[model samples]
Target: MNIRKTVARVAGVGAVATAALGLFSTGAANADTFIPLPGGEITQTLSDGTVVTIKLVGESANISGSMGATPVHRNAWVSASAQVQISGDTSATGGKIFPGYVVGCQVTIDGGNVNGGASGGVSWDNSGNATPSASANSGANLTLGPGQAKSFYVLDQEVPDDYGNESHKTRNKFTGNSGSVTWSDETIGLNGCAGYAQARSFVSVEVETDNVISWVTLWGQPFSLG
Candidate 1:
């Protein structure tokens, strides 16, 4: 049947401390599995004495086993909030929040940070100051075979640029001491993978201060996409 789904977004309302699981459908044979995830947090101090903290909260997922009634098709809905905090006397000004996910088909994606890059399911840097890679897509719909994986951002905001031209952005820009972005019911439709699949969340932030500019990223626990 070639079932397809579209991604949805909603404005964030800060971080939520409590989360729980729920069901999607009442049918016994085709009911979706709801999972409440324990999101993650990270704190890093920049060389210029600026502090950056990133958090992923209120994460959950609803998974459908067979989207198109075929073994090669799967789909899921994910929700989460990405929050950033900047502090220090360096006059840390503003930053950008890039929230995304990596999906793997029959491949292990628990390798942690991949040389401080976000390519080929490698994840963010463990040192907390690696520059973010520019290899992420802006959509959630994806396709992969066994031993393959891909990463994509959650935001596709359209706005006017400096020249008044239409611009598409994948990251939320925030100014001041704190900023946050939230999304609900984002769709992830996969195809061509007949084996087990998995997905993990990531929050990458770019911090800019009067003295220096740096990046900090936080990775979430991986979960199945059955």
Candidate 2:
């Protein structure tokens, strides 16, 4: 009886392995690169009144100068536009929230001054009289269930150079007569926060793109109050 049982188990194991091989030989298969323990999406957009959820993943990011002198690195960033809706407080200022790269990942948002550049934002008031301000870098720590661990490096800071670049920092619009050109609301750690100006607000949303992994384990479905 013992011999029979041993042979049966061996045959079953061989058969299972063979089946797995056959499946892989098929044309295509859906596979995940990293499996989040009870995981899900990352990209999120939050405003004074609304919240938008976007599918996102960690991607390598960096910033360097024309001479390669200044270099700032970040784990990842939001690839493109994320949806947003104002919260209950219409006048409440907003800020960008970035889930830094891997918890252990060390990163930085160069925060260069591109205030006068073509791509930089126009101008705005910074006289402390209700000016629009916000930014996103890359990190955050979330608690799923009781003790369930999920941590991401995040970059969040008060806008020091609203419309300025590393080249020329500190340009106040409300207080100064510089036409209040326009503040670069997008706080990109890689560009040192250099970008063509656009919409002005206190809230910002960040996300990651291009996972490039063999497996991606999703957490739970997104939970939003919006």
Candidate 3:
């Protein structure tokens, strides 16, 4: 009877262990490993004590591919929206605020014709010639490896009192009031790119009157592209 009891106890323990392993496997299979990015809100106080705030709304990406070439190339199109608000003691002197969206893209390829499995690169462009500084607007460029490429696109820009001139330097002006402006569905597209790619959205602001500039980037969840 003692031997029989011992045998029963061991069998029970084995059953429990098997059940626990099954549960663990099921949990692991059901768990999601992806993490989403956060929408961003940034505020900056100008030199003249003017408070400016920028907030990101919704952002997304659409990816496509072309099959004609020896090395398959992927295209990613990105879109985003944001709002900018200005307040605080603008009565002293009227100020102008330039607000716009910028999209930056980075791509990585494996054993492709581009980088030969080297690191990829990144690049940037602005729809409006607005820079963080008071000088001429200069875009950003980056080089990446492991078969990678990057580019930036400028989305819709709001110029408060734009007279529809050829000058790209247009922005929102606050004569003596507090207000906000929101943009929706600003889009940028990239083509003839290959490999895994991701895009980021940014809200660029320039306070012309106060000579202050700030940038708010929305690093929200990156979408996958073929």
Candidate 4:
């Protein structure tokens, strides 16, 4: 249950200036399409009576067509804020929050497949037990073919381990009733895919109690990558 916390702050005026530069910087080669997304929220109560709430706010993506100057490549920059709140008795000290995204190539992530299997390695089961695959990578630069998808964490925090060695983690651990993580202009580079693609955000929190441990996940609306 060891995790690191990283916070980034951006002033309103600075953000506006950055956007202006990105829009008027170049003609078509650097023409980035800014998309404002409607983030989502969810709440779940664990079996041990611990209530966990997750929210994704200020979601957005700026897509630039074919950074490789070829049809088989795509690139985008994403931003979002994931907030978590935990409430229960004394046993519910706190939890760990893991936030990431799933990118799919010609694959639908909004719903289940025809066979009710996981869509692009993500499960949105109705039993309030949604979870992402453990195969997610830490790097957003990825390669995929048709009918393929991959997941990656937004955080790559570097810290020291118990033995004073360098270590990396993708989650933020909190010991109170609330915690949050936010990222801005994170890169999502895709290669080897010539068709339409999509990306979705997820926040999974691991709640630890004296008697039981559980997880609750909240999924954001999926958006196109191309």
* Residue pairs in clash, model 1: none
Q: lDDT for model 2, please.
A: 0.18
lDDT score, residue 40, model 2?
22
lDDT of 3 by residue, 102-184 (tens): 22223322111112221211122222222333332312222222234432323223334466655433234344433333332
Question: Please, what are the lDDT tens digits per residue for candidate 1 over residues 85-158?
Answer: 88876676777776677777777766553222335422433432223355544666666777777677777667
State residue 8's C-alpha deviation in candidate 3, in Å: 64
Candidate 4 — which pairs collide? Answer: none
* lDDT, candidate 4, at 115: 21
Candidate 4 C-alpha lDDT tens digits along 92-118: 877766676667777776642212233
TM-score of each: 0.79, 0.20, 0.45, 0.78
Given candidate 2, what's the lDDT at residue 112?
Answer: 17
Best by lDDT: 1
lDDT against true structure, model 4:
0.60
Clash number by candidate, in order: 0, 58, 15, 0
**Could you tell me which 10 consecutive residues in candidate 1 have the lowest summed lDDT?**
18-27
Q: Give residue 81's lDDT in candidate 4 (0 to 100).
A: 73
**TM-score, cand. 2 vs. native:** 0.20
Q: What is residue 56's positional error in candidate 2, in angstroms?
A: 6.2
Could you list the CA RMSD of all candidates, in the order they appear? 9.4, 24.6, 21.8, 7.9
